[model samples]
Target: MRSAPDDDRPGRVIPFGKGRDRAYDAYGHAYDADEARGDHGAERRVDHLTRFMDFLRRRVAGDYEVDEFGFDPELTDKVTLELMRPLYRTWFRVETLGAGDVPAESGALIVANHSGTLPLDALMLQVAMHDEVGRPLRLLGADLVYQLPVLNHLARKTGHTLACREDADRLLRKGEAVGVFPEGFKGVGKPFSERYRLQRFGRGGFVASAIRAGVPIVPCAIVGAEEIYPKIGDLPVLARILGLPYLPITPLFPWFGPLGLIPLPSKWMIEFGEPIRTDDYDPGAADDPMLVFNLTDHVREIMQQMLNELRLRRGHAFPPLF
Candidate 1:
């Protein structure tokens, strides 16, 4: 069993089977500091390898269905995880906290303040959940995401679904991790003046979803995302013409042309606060404005605290240059 690190440290990649194009994560899991041999340990590796060969043989013999879960028993959960190593490394230099609080097999609603203005924070969070926390988190993406060509395909492959309550309920019922940004596009597109200040969590859909599903809510706070592409202004007419939600005018890119899209190397801090249990709440509590308001206020407070703490932790904010 290859152990992942408890803290967010740098990671490297190692190749898997020949011509596989897959990679193994040298970095350990979020809570696991015990470094074990990769491939989930030697015996497990052999088992998976054998199973994979058997799977291939069966495929060649036309005796299998690829869609079935665990169809390739040889490719254990460990192997599947290894394939994601490279993706995490390229996107984030994450600093994690409260990872040990995550339950091994319980459903969770990960509520985060959406920043990065581009939804990259969501993808980074998903990668962190899967590779660092050792589990896949189903993301609730916006409807606009599915409208794009490649983005839509990648989102599905990465286990994202349309932001719908039914989908959330179904996943939680199955003990799966689900992530949602209550701010939605409004939060992401907020001006630079509003950086780190969370928008209102509308009608408490997340609260309702959690209460209905009887799951705990995990408040996630992310710093350094706001600097990714600081929106100095919005060209609403151009945005409408382009069919975009907002026409962002960052310091670079549109202002300075295409070069603006490159995100500055701002160190990232992502902390998961202790879970707020809704399991004990009355199912009808969703309609109570007091309940929704309190919950939203509570989560917002935690996120703000994290932002303040991370600002101190980082010593100084990196000059916000998009």
Candidate 2:
């Protein structure tokens, strides 16, 4: 019979629509999102504050832990990365490409050109990797980085270690993302005229480390760092006195005092290329100097090509602020 028309029938269909559900909207959400726009913002603020408070509590109670490399993941994630996000997002407006090429959970070595006056590029790269792919890029630093008191402390806490084969191998074997700037100070301290020109990758140490760890090597290209502080000149005497690689003399820096230290708001682009697999190599291939050297050169060439392409895409350094 058509007695109750199927309204009370078993498993009755509700026909999708806002007013169709007796409880809440089935198409949109359990609650009307449009009706509470301001509420979301307020909730976010509350959540942020709560997290900050929790961080402070951990610091006070000494409840934080560090890895074997003295990497304080808590501080790096809660404080360091959060602080760098604004610079990566607004100031430099860094745009990342091919980030998905990075291995999701496996070990990999990232080889990239280094630039920018003070290694800001490294920090930006680290932030980008962590934010985009949810992985930490452990940077290998030179000896000088660990000699200075303040910089040494910060470096260790932020997961940086001596740029040695031992450390790199250890990190890679642990399934962690390792990053190396093979050019050292050469690429970062080069003159403005030589911008985007890669320097000789020292001895291919990074390649050997990757091979030993049986990890893929991902070549990365970073553009726009060259113009940030524009290494117009260098003060060798001052650099020697300060124990710095080079005392960069940008147009504004050391002239305008602290104001000169401000980096120009240049557009930045980072590209991660496909990983070159090392696991396929035969036994003991890591000890072969020629293979390591060849791989190193290949990575460098790919990075340079990527830089050239990215430069064309970025056009000029600065864009309209608005």
Candidate 3:
């Protein structure tokens, strides 16, 4: 038999050996050699906590600007968005295509498909544009978003406002990039079978807004959000009672209780297509129904095509496109 190996390694030594019992103290407590060692993980957490507290102090001191719509860039960047960063980067593993296509300076309209049951896609897009494109995207939200007291306050702080032509035009005129989901509740509340299908673009109002603002329209196709929730059914009666558009019933939701509320860890892709310049069209062209309709149809077609291409690239929703 070979001689017993030396226990002289760099780190603390464990007591147990080939045949020896654990080393114990007089009180019968086994000696733990590593107990006094520092934990790197704890050290890292303390560093992060220190940074976050500093950020909060700056915010509380009013060291940030707030826009007319109640957008607080400092608070959003330091707090609200920081909370979503892990989800966007780690959980969803969001990948962006054509992010460079987004105009670096001038205003533009970003129109994307909406799903994911909880509007988490919008939050992800906000993070993506801010992180990858180096620009803050002002989102156009539904009235329902503003009706909820706490959510409304948070939405405004995160740079989201009512999705109407007035707000859209205002933001664009101010040289702010605006994001809109024309599908609204229709796309978000649709069944899983209808996933990736482009719904009606809602009378081309967004196109008209873009035209009036003389900004380019950038069609965005977001994949993976549809599978996150996977709406299998709806409870219209309960929805009516609750004043919601539709009560979504996902496969895991309402069955697994609170645990089911967590979204599936699906890979996400957000691709921005080339901009469609509305500057080429006369401003008065916005008043033309046919013109708006044609532009809307064109945008819808472009987004749909991009979605299909991204889907092919993705290959699967669960494993994601790594």
Which numbered prediction scores highest in TM-score against the true structure? 2
Stretches of model 2 off by over 4 angstroms after superposition: 1-51, 320-322
Q: What lDDT tens digits, residue by residue, belong to model 2 across residues 110-225?
A: 99999987799999999888777667779999899999989998998988899998999899989989999999999889999999999999999888888888899999999989
Evaluate residue 44 in candidate 1 and report its C-alpha lDDT on the 0 to 100 scale. 49
What tens-digit string does per-residue lDDT give for candidate 1 at 240-272?
A: 999998988888858667778777666677788
Ranking according to lDDT, highest score first = 3, 2, 1
Q: Which ten residues in a row have the lowest lDDT in candidate 2?
A: 1-10
- Candidate 3 global CA lDDT score: 0.82
Please tell me which model should have the higher lDDT, number 1 or number 2: 2
Model 3, 70-98: lDDT tens per residue? 98766676567668989999999999889
C-alpha lDDT score of every prediction, in listed order: 0.68, 0.81, 0.82
| Model 1 TM-score relative to the real fold | 0.74
> How accurate locally is residue 174 in candidate 1, as Cα lDDT from 0 to 100?
81
